[model samples]
Target: MQVIRNGFLSLLALGALTLEGHAQAVVAALECDFPAASTDDWNMAASTLQYYIDTARGWRVDEDSFSFDGTANIVVDGKDHVASLSITVSRQSGRANKTLRSEGRSLTVSGECRKMEASGRKF
Candidate 1:
């Protein structure tokens, strides 16, 4: 009887621990998109975004690609520093030649992200 009772109590404890693990909140990656006015316009915008992510402390820029549309993944650590920034840009041209004047390029960036550490406690 004693052995059976002990085994049952142990099982219950294990179940409680599993439930607690599932209850913990996890930080998820945030995604964002920046649309360019023209295919040529993306070069400047993407460059600016990369610069911001690289310069920020503790922040990381994971990957970058450009075509016609642009997308980026930015990661910030618990210290509000950037952990990673992955970007994709796409563009398509058939017949017309595209020319981008250097002087016309303008970029502006502002903002900050805070990071939260994951608790070891389950759920």
Candidate 2:
């Protein structure tokens, strides 16, 4: 059986990701301890609702059955400090691995992600 599959149930697989029971691609924020760059962060744009990071732009989130199904496989462009970031969150352990290829820097980050409050930060 494939663990969590879509909807709020999928959030159950990602311990760091949690919403108010309404999980249909909601705007959320990600804060991780990136040793390569502490300022590096991530968030799901409220407007595009697309996942992106602070390293640089040009990120295309691929659509697939695994998407929003416990594991998020994001494909990135061949440029920028954060070349690629793929997160496989499990209900037991939630962590983000970051690598800045330019400097050969790498680190593992862990933090909580919650539903972002609309309005002030809303796009």
Candidate 3:
């Protein structure tokens, strides 16, 4: 009876540990899209988004987007440009939604994906 109880408790502890590990998995990439924009516009928007993500601290360029371990803020300085943009990313899970406003235009993109593979030229 003692051995059986110990084994049961051990299994429960292992199961809880597994769940905790999965809950802390890092978000690998962000899937972004501009559905209403044209191909050229989408390309430009994706490029600008990538630029912002690249400039953020603790983030590394991963083909199209940026990858980071923890939470970070993406801030774009307007300078000679019209408007600036700011995006906050939390790497707790596979979920993200960010918006960029510039030159009287707003671009929104979302979805945290596993891989950084691009489907096509225009995002």
Best candidate, TM-score: 3
Off by over 4 Å in 2: 1-25, 34-92, 103-123
- Candidates in order have lDDT scores of 0.23, 0.27, 0.34
Candidate 3 C-alpha lDDT tens digits along 1-123? 011101111211111123655542222333333222223232222331221233234545444434444322223342333333334444444344545455555555554433244432222
Collision count for each candidate, in order: 20, 0, 0
Which candidate, 1 or 2, has the higher TM-score?
2
Q: How close is every model to the real structure, measured as TM-score?
A: 0.17, 0.25, 0.28
lDDT value, residue 110 of candidate 2:
37
Give the range where candidate 1 is weakest over 10 consecutive residues by summed lDDT.
Answer: 1-10
Residue-by-residue lDDT tens digits, candidate 2, 1-123: 111112121222121233776543432333222222232443221111212221112222332101131223322243323233334222233233322222333323433333233421122
Cα RMSD, model 1? 21.8
Candidate 2 weakest ten by summed lDDT:
1-10
- Evaluate model 2: give its lDDT: 0.27
The full ranking of all candidates by TM-score, starting with the best, is 3, 2, 1
